[model samples]
Target: MSLSKGRISLIMNRNIQKIFLLGLLVSSTAVFSQIQEERLILNKKREPEVKKIEKKKTSVETIKNYPPEEKSAVPVEYEITNVPAVSDFKTSTIQGEDLSPKFDSELQKNYFRLGYGNYGKFLADGNISGNLQNQMEVGANVHYISTEGLKKEYPWSSKQSSAALGGFLTSYGESGKFNLNAEYNLIDYNYYGIYALQPAADVDLSQKTNQFTVDGYYDFYTNNILNDARVKSSFLGDKFDAKESNVSAMLNLSKHAVQLPANGITMNADLGLGIETLNSEFAILNKNYSNYFNADIAPKVTFFSGNSYVMLGSSFSFLNSKNKNLLTTDEVKSNKAYWFPKAEILYAATEEFKFYAGVDGGLKMNSYASMLQENPYLVSDQVIKPTETKYNIYFGLKGDLNQNLKFDVNAGFGKVKNILLYEANGLFDNNATLNRSAYNFANTFSAVYDNGNVSTITGNLQYYPLANLTLEAELNFASYRLENLEKAYNRPMVKGTLGAKYTMLDKKLHLGFKGFLMSEKPTNSFQIVETPNPNVSNSTIYQNVENRNDSVAGHADFNLSAEYKVHKNFSIFALGNNLMTQKYETFKGYKVLGPQILGGVKISF
Candidate 1:
């Protein structure tokens, strides 16, 4: 029997379910045994009941009084208890009366005009009050990213060094009934060098990249109508690289209401236009790869009700380019349209439980050839086709049982048609051949977790036994099949994390400890050239090689932080991460930066 990737993933999900059930059973059994023992002990110490008293003397005394009472039965009797009379809890007071007249002047000048108004009135009044507020932030980081293991795998040694400087400034203002806001940010990244061995010689290469963005927004409202507009743009450039730019603008209009409905519904729509351009020297290698411009306009509509919501969105983009490369030499021009239709339904079953399900799908124009042509290093002489399509369907449930317990489970399936892959040939050939290469075409596969044929199950639990303390644990399991030579290979990856935190010094100090465990067996596929049949059609063969380094590894991290308030406007603090200096990899073959120690003071008003 042959098992498909989807089937394999389903089987894995079932196994995880079984494991969860077994764990639940064990926990329930322990709790049940304890309850039974407690009940038995309580029953062993039962108490006896007592009986009570005779009325023979009272009957003799009542005989004479009954006859006299019958003769005077006409007299009415009334009884009153010595209890206090009920009083009204509600108080009535005259309106428009000043309760605190002594502070009226101060309230009108400082509190009423600028601070103590209702939220909406205060905000609107401030907009017309002509006031400006500015904020600025500046910080620097010294980062080091090394690929030591990656270097060892290749023919040369490599290391990543980064010294970054970044900052932002923002300002806001109000004029009459209008408000304006603006901000700017800048960041730079410089790479020292990359050590690698090319066929000609060993070389060291370096590059630098800088990015800048600016944004602005204006909002104004009058009577029942509101208007908002915004503009944003970003530019990125790198040494020995092409520059890219993105600019966009949007405007919105809506109506205001004096009082909103208890069961409210809102309908909002947006129309926007944007342009993106990319230019680079790398485009010279492939005529099909050149500077190109894309213009797009999109409209989105969203509807929200009590428990149901839907969104419909679509975009049409036009591509324009002049290619000097042979593949794109035909004056590439194309128009593409995309659309998304999605809806969600939610039910509140109880105070502690809720259920939800959603389905979202979209149509996208896929360019297989354009993607391949852009990456010259992938393979030689590859022809990519444009216009592929994809669709996705999903259903899930999410909710919480109590404040300390919560869960979410979702399953989805997606498919891509006319996808692209690569095939390669050795030594002098620069082009890719489908027969010589293991994968050379745009291939389509069902969408699973992490772009592989995998099913993932994740869950978390939290317990808080004391105030200012918390303990949390998380677990994830993934089962998938790696395809090679038209066969399915089963692989599983499992990861877990457990952590606890304690707060002290009136929550000014915090301490935490965390541990992580991960295990996985990765299947590697490669193509090898047969020595004797170098010219034969089947000279290259694809095989799945099992990497034996699948082992469970774990490490613990300890962190401590303390904050001391010097005054209302100023404070000092000490923070430490990875205080234990434990040796571990944040990921496979990637060693973590051991420990960092820093202290700083913050001032706020």
Candidate 2:
């Protein structure tokens, strides 16, 4: 109805000129999309807005090239002439170990100890080793001591015991060294001097007596000339049914003959052979004893300079003695031949100083295992003889008085023929007209062969003030002149010994001390008949055989030891033995068991 407003204002002026031409084509396409205004030239000043990139793909293939070959270059050379000089050069010291599964390793010195004391004493010791190859070495050892003796107010019955066990093997080679040793021993004794006159005389004397031993040793050395070879063996037994066995062998041969230059004057020679045999069957309470066979030949000559050495020797012996009786057809035989003249002289005024002189004599083999090692109460028909040592003159002085000192001094003189003395049996005052012979019980002992002259003086010393401290001393003096067993009975004319050692904390504490001294000797006595039986035969013979003298009293002994090292295989030890003596007798009537104190622990793996 209103179409006539100038025809709607001319259609709004053609839609306002088509909305102003679409707003000028969207403001000129947002001002050229806001990013392409980077163009400068002619006064070039508007440069901002440049991030438009789009080009076409481009690819190109390559070409290859190869060519090369060349060689030439060499230089390396080293050469030097011969060289060798060194008589001897040595440097060795490398011993370290600790492969940790620790057991006190310092190569584990191996040890074991046990102790107990106070009358019934017991002690044990042990050592063990290993290294089975690479030169081989092996070892084992054990020793035991026992006592339950004396002291019941001491009327009799003094006991003793000893035990040992051992094994050893050593082998090294590149030419030489070998050592082997074996041992077993046990000894027990009692009989209590017939109970010092039968204190209630019932007799069962504990361990009447016993001894068993087995020993063996073999040695071989080489430096040429078969330098050494030795074999020693012993088998012993006793417990009534006596038995003794011994074997010995020795051979040594050497030569240098003559060689002189540098330290000049050298001549040496040696040859020696020895053989010994002994077998015995003795039963003391039941007699049957004596047997021996011996042989020897020794020759030596030596002369050396660069500080003297001279030795000339000769010894040849062949001896055989046997006593065959078997109760009845008594027979005693002897065959002997001997000659000896030996000498030794050594001098070295320096190199620690030394001087020595010697003259020797021999033929001193007597058996029943050498009188049971010098009187184990000798009786059982003893009369095997060979003592003759017509000469033994010795002089010595050994030195090293500075590096903590060491010294030795000796002087000696000897002349002996039979020289065996000990006699008591019943002192033979006609033991009931010589009809009493079951040892005649003056506590048994008989063996007398005299003819003697001996004099000796000796001294020994070692001292180290500090460097762990140590000191030792030994002195001996002797004099015996017997021509028919007038005296020199028990035989001991002063002997002394002393030793000490000390180490402090850093060494884990250790201290040791020892001492020994002996003096009085002569002994022989008799008196036995009992009852009114005494006056019956004018029984007042204090000591017959024209009154033999008597003596016996000399004793001194000491021992002290301490060790403490908590661990490194653990250690703790203490021993105070015979600490100034509670008992001592070097055997006249035998009494030994002492001040013993004990404590123990020592283990090393």
Candidate 3:
């Protein structure tokens, strides 16, 4: 192409510009290469060195190339040296008396005791028990106690003899165990009532009683549950011209029914049946013979959770009584039904504290035998009935204070129906007959029934300061509200007992002391006197006198007993009763025995 001089110059200028541009590009490329090389060098310097490992030679080649160096044992020269050893020990021979046979308290099973006291009291007791086989044990016990009157002229002497035989059998299978027991008791007591009115000849105002009891139990167990059964029967006879006899029997059964939704809680049931009869001949009362029968059934649900427990159930009972008139021509029959609600709850707040509450009620049979045992100065004319505990609600805290101490405080409230009470019986005479017979005109007490509401608060404590020493105390306070009576007879307001026991010389000697106290209570006294009645027939009318002491002073008794074991099988004991107490009367016109001291020897095998 042809171009002007200016265009040619422009073309040359353009070629020159292109050359400049290419050179600039080459310069930039060189600078970039240098930068990359410098960066790679810096990276190589920053990274740590990684050495190359050489491949191991074959076994034969390695052995030939690296020959093992030979080693020889170096002989070490020993220098003779001695080190003195020291010890702080001395040996000596111990000399002691040669005790060929060790005395073991656990080996002694049979025991006998004989005692005599200043009040012409005599006592004899013996017990023997031994293993018949690996799973059986048999035992027998006998006791004879006799005491003369505190005063020779009082004509009040008591004697009692009792014997018991028992056996226990254990089975390895589901049939758990069996317990059988039999007992017989003979008692002789005198009715020295109304000392001023006793005849000069004393008339041998004594009576005899005989009691026999048989008890049997059978246990069937699965795992750890106790669903067993038992039966007990007892017979009592009072020799008041061979007229009084009492028979009682009871049967109990328990079983597990179902499992609850929660763990460890179970539903269970229990059934019981009881029958009692009292046959007596009393000339004073229109009804002389009575028979009582009762049956009870209860179904319970027990809930046992961690640190908590509860039991709920209800009991149903049926009672029937038949009374025959004195003339043996009229009969009175009565039947009743009772429902008792029962519940118990316990919560363990801590390892050492437990709080418990419960509500329970039941029927208690009051029979002639029971009354006579509680009060031996009772007349033959008595009423047999059942006491109904409508409901008893109680709450308590019981736990261990420490390793060696324990305590409990409880309070309760309840109402009892047809409660038994003892009251003096005054003499009665009709215009046609002059009643001077000892059996009819006897100076004794009788059982009376009344209703009452009671409230009680109690506390118990036990302390063991030493392994062989223990101290205990209990206090009880009770209040009563009677329905028809002015006061609750013989029901103490406050009662307490303090006791301590100590064993020294490796159980060779034991000392026991106890103190008892009770608050004052009411007592009833009665008498009879003849009054001339002009309006009535010319016969002397007999008027009854009744007196009641609302506040009979309480009594305190301190008893101390000590036993020194001479040998493993022999012991000497001394007992002091009423050691530091004044003369007191537990019942009206009946004084307790004076201070008594008794010494005895006991032997055990």
Candidate 4:
């Protein structure tokens, strides 16, 4: 159950008053107790002495006391032994998730932007425009996230487990009629033990993930300066605890342009290769699962003009394996080919309206057999064929009314044929589920068939009534049909937000309030399967067996911030978020915390 905003506010106010009264009472009691203790001490009677005669006799006897002689002190020297050398060899266990280093060398660095440029008056004599600029960034971030849920013995846990240490440096020069640019990014990310939940009891999996990517590109243009060439490349590597390293790379070349006659155009061609060296333990699993090594080369091209465009592409892939236990595992390699083609058109009817439509068709090869061999399942067949073909078409419209209002609407329909699907056997079986499947899975391997059609529509609207107020709304609806299934499912989601901001004290202080509402139905097939198995076998029946009553969720966030500048480079500020103390749920059963406040100082130069 959730409380309304008004009720929560009232309770908070009452609690605040009670806290103040309790604090006052505690302070008064402490002061009264101290005063009583002091009074009791002052009331005690003091003793009087009667020793005049004794004092006179004692003084006479003390007059005969003599003084002692002074003596010189001697210093002693102590021998210091050489400290024994500490052993450099030490042993420590690398256990637990937090064992990784928290800091890196590149984290301590500053970035600067440099440039050189000139501008001159042109009048009617000549036209010229050019500039040179260089920019770079160097920084690292360490983030930690943990989550635990009910209905589970061992909490499902996942760690990002990464330390990305690298940066990008780029330079650019631009001139009229011609432009040139070149940039390179050198990045390395080391990932370890990033896992997802599986049905296996008391059994967890781990992997070693690392990747180094270097990207550089250049472009040149002349005459109308309508087009340019571009190139890109990337390399990736992964190592699982049970499997050795698998590395892959892709390189692509493309031509880019803006408004090629009627519209924009881009054409690209790519080549790729991959290699995997499996460890002994994983090799056994691969042999039983009919795993294979694979590589591919692809070429693609696209053309765009006016309100329409077209694209064509294809790829050739090769697979090889050496396993006798499974079919297609005895070095019985095969070559596969695929093709994709697409076309689209868009037109603007007026200043306030536009329309777009497009269709795409493609074939995709399956790589799951090689990708998921580490599981405890046996494979009856290793070489899964490519998807037959797929196509999609979409249309949309966007426009603006007046200066402060805008709206957009779009709809798309798609169909897929002969799509590749995974079939799992029993729980804990290597062939039961895809090793890489995260958060979405059903029982063990069965005869998996995939063919589906989907349609979706989305609409969004934004309006601003005043300079500081805005309102926005968006809605989406989608329906999906599996060719092998009898029934189609529909999902509808909606979100809306309204916000306003006001500035005061010469615009140095600002206050803002925003309210947002979101609602969605669990229309996903995976989510629906949580219900009891239906009696009907041929027809797909979706029954609403459970109602979490949390689909309708909303919250209001209020921000009160003030900034006071004390000097040219220093300022003090206070910021508070979620000041309304509203409580709500984000997902079906996930409760969100409320009401946080923060204040700090900022220095800038």
Top-scoring candidate (TM-score): 3
**Error in Å for residue 399 of model 3:** 1.5
Instruction: Residues 1-605, candidate 4: write the lDDT tens digits.
Output: 00000110001122221000000010011110000111111111111112101111111110011101110011111111111010000000010011100011111122111111111100000011112232222122122111111112223322212223332332333411111122121111111111222344322323333333333333222212222333323233334322222333333333333334442553322232333322112222233332445555555454544323344555555545433343343544434444444555545566467565666565443332232321112122233444544567777776655434556677878887754443332222223233433212222122244678867676665554544333444455556577764332112244333334444454344344433444443311222222333564544433322222223244333434344545535545443434565434332222322343334444433
Q: Per-residue lDDT of 90-177 in model 1, one digit per residue for the tens?
A: 0000000001111011111111111111111110000011113332212211111111222322332222222222222223223212
Return the TM-score for each candidate structure: 0.47, 0.28, 0.74, 0.43
Clashes of each: 11, 0, 0, 14
lDDT of 1 at 378: 28
How much does candidate 2 score in TM-score? 0.28
Sequence-dependent TM-score of model 1 = 0.47
Per-residue lDDT of 496 in model 3:
72
lDDT per residue as tens, model 3, 174-227: 245555667675666555444324454445566566767666665443322444
Candidate 3, residue 86: how far the Cα is off, in Å: 68
CA lDDT, every model vs. true structure: 0.31, 0.52, 0.53, 0.31
List runs of model 3 lying over 4 Å from the truth: 1-108, 152-174, 195-198, 223-226, 241-287, 327-329, 428-442, 528-543
